[model samples]
Target: MLTRFVHSGPVRLWTQHLGHPTDPTILLVMGTATQGIGWPDELMRTLADNGRHVIRFDHRDTGRSDTVDFTTHPYTLADMAADTTAVLDGHAIPAAHIAGISLGATIGQWLAVHHAARVHTLTTIAASPMGNNPGPAWTRALTGQPAAPDELPPPTARFLNHLTASAQTPRTTHQQRIDADVQTWRVLNGDTLPFDEPAARQFVEHSYTRATDLTAATNHDRAGRHWDDNRRAPLSAITAPTLVLHGSADPLFPQHTAKPWQHRSRQPD
Candidate 1:
């Protein structure tokens, strides 16, 4: 694996490359606030071992990449899409298959919508239509809407811990930080998969040592507000073969959110 900085216009991105240049490329896009290194090595190597070149890079405000203050018109989802292309340009790759998770999925969908030629295939994991689909009641509650009488209140304690973890300063001892990370991941783990405490702890420690940015998640969420006007991009516009993957037990985004995308991306008769 090679780790280095790749420039996309004025933005310098921290990137990691695995596998040979001759192999087909797979660009992995991570969701809001998370650094590219957060991607598991096993997953990247598994794909690379099967003759694929895997690339993962830190977004502008995260990890070792350039930082942005969310106050100014900062960046937006569209800018992030362009960042993906810039990464490809930096690597001299004309085009490649893309797989995205959470906010990354939103970026991939927009890339396919507006830059169809640049995408060979797209896989969106654990995300929903951009802005408004009347998500679940939990989503509504989180967004400050009045919860339906029957709807359950948002899980504040659990969610707040995640925010607390993201905003944790590196000033704390490494072990304490890793322990906080473990707790956060424990809360977010899906029911279908057993939590791997040791692995999660190791990953948290590795990412901490690599880079730390307390404001990444908040800045990322701010940047994503660019889609506020047209939250839901037109999925039918995407011509590439697309796959929507969501866990049935995903707490952040319900599995049903994937249906509209699956329905919209179908080929015309």
Candidate 2:
């Protein structure tokens, strides 16, 4: 694996590449507040072994990437989408198969609709059709506005409660922050799957130690409030072949959230 920093205009994004440059490229975009390493090494190797070049990058304010002050340099998802293209440009890749999860998935959708030529195929996991607009509750929290009548369902009460509790709790010490991350993943992993606490804790520890400013990751949530893209087109505008994947146990986005994407992409549910 090769890791380096790539420039996205004034921002610098930390990126990693696996597999030969000659192979078909696959760009992996992770969720909100997640760094590039959030894509497990095993998964990257599996894709590389399958005859594909894989790339992953840290979004601004996460991992080793530059952190912007929202007060002075607030940016929208469109800017994030541009950052994605900058990764491609830096690698001298004209296009690649795009795969994203959660907020990353929403960025993939935006790329497919706006930067269609840069996307060969699109795969979205645990995401809503639109950006992080996770229904009425989130809408109220972010924008102080009620959601449209047809918006997707809100996240589960359990998940919301966990978020609230986490926010209220202090994590001033390194160990406390590590513990918080482990618990956060436990909630996200849900009850259906085996909760690998040791592995989760190890990963969180590594991430926390490697981060330039761990708390700066919260800028992503703040960025959501400043989202001002009025030119966002519908999903039907996407011409790339699409696959939508959603877990039934996803606490943030319910299974029903995938229906609109499936219908729009003309993919079987």
Candidate 3:
């Protein structure tokens, strides 16, 4: 793997590349408050071995990327989309296939809509449509509005309760913070899958140790509240071929949330 820093205007993002640059590029965008390393090394290797150039990056306020005070330098998802373009630009790549999870998936939709030419293809996992009403219960808490009748169902109560309890519990020590991350994954992993506590713990520890300022990652939540673009284009604006994936046991975005995306694009063969 090759690591480098890419500049997005004033912000700097830490990016890593695997596989040969000559191959088709796949840009992996991770979830909110999560870094590039959240895309496991094993998965990266598999994609690389398949003759694809894979790129992953730390979002502006996560991992080794530059952290900004959201109060002074607030940014929207549109801005985050621009950051992805910067990563491509830094590598002299004109376009790439985008695979994003959770909040990353939302940003992928934004790129597909506004910067259509830059997106070769889009893969959205565990995400609701971009311009649609919010799908997560936490988003309702953030916006102080209820989901419309046509919108996807909110997250499960069990998951919301876990988030609440986790937020309220203070983690003053490094080990406490690491444990908190492990527990968060346990809840997110759901009941069907065996929770790999050892692997989760190792990833969490690595992320925690590499972070520039873990607390600063909360800036993403703050940024979400202050999205500057009010007139968002509909998901229909996406011209790229799309793939949508959602786990049946996803606690945050229920399986039904994937329906709209499937209906919007032709099914992948």
Q: For candidate 3, lDDT tens digit of each residue in 1-269?
A: 99989999999999999999999999999988998999989899999999999999999999999999887778878788889999999988899999999889989988888888999999999876665445354577445567554456677777877878998877988788888889999999988889999999998888888999988888877666544343256677789999999898888776554555554332112
In model 2, which regions exceed 4 Å deviation? 139-149, 229-232, 257-269
1 or 3, greater by TM-score: 3
Q: Judging by lDDT, tell me the better candidate of 1 and 2.
A: 2
Ranked candidates, highest TM-score first? 2, 3, 1
User: Residues 1-269, candidate 2, lDDT per residue (tens digit)?
Assistant: 99978899999999999999989999999889998888999999999999999999999988889988877888888888899999999999999999999889988998998889999999999887754344355656444455444555566667777888999878888788788889999989888889999999988888877788887888887765554443335677789999999898887776544545553342212
Off by over 4 Å in 1: 133-176, 228-231, 257-269
Q: Candidate 2: TM-score?
A: 0.89
Candidate 2 lDDT (Cα, 0 to 1):
0.83
Give the Cα lDDT of each candidate: 0.76, 0.83, 0.84
lDDT of 2 at 165: 93
Count of residue pairs whose backbone atoms collide, per candidate: 1, 0, 0
What's the best-to-worst order under lDDT?
3, 2, 1
Q: Which candidate's lDDT is highest?
A: 3
Error of 1 at 174 (Å): 5.3
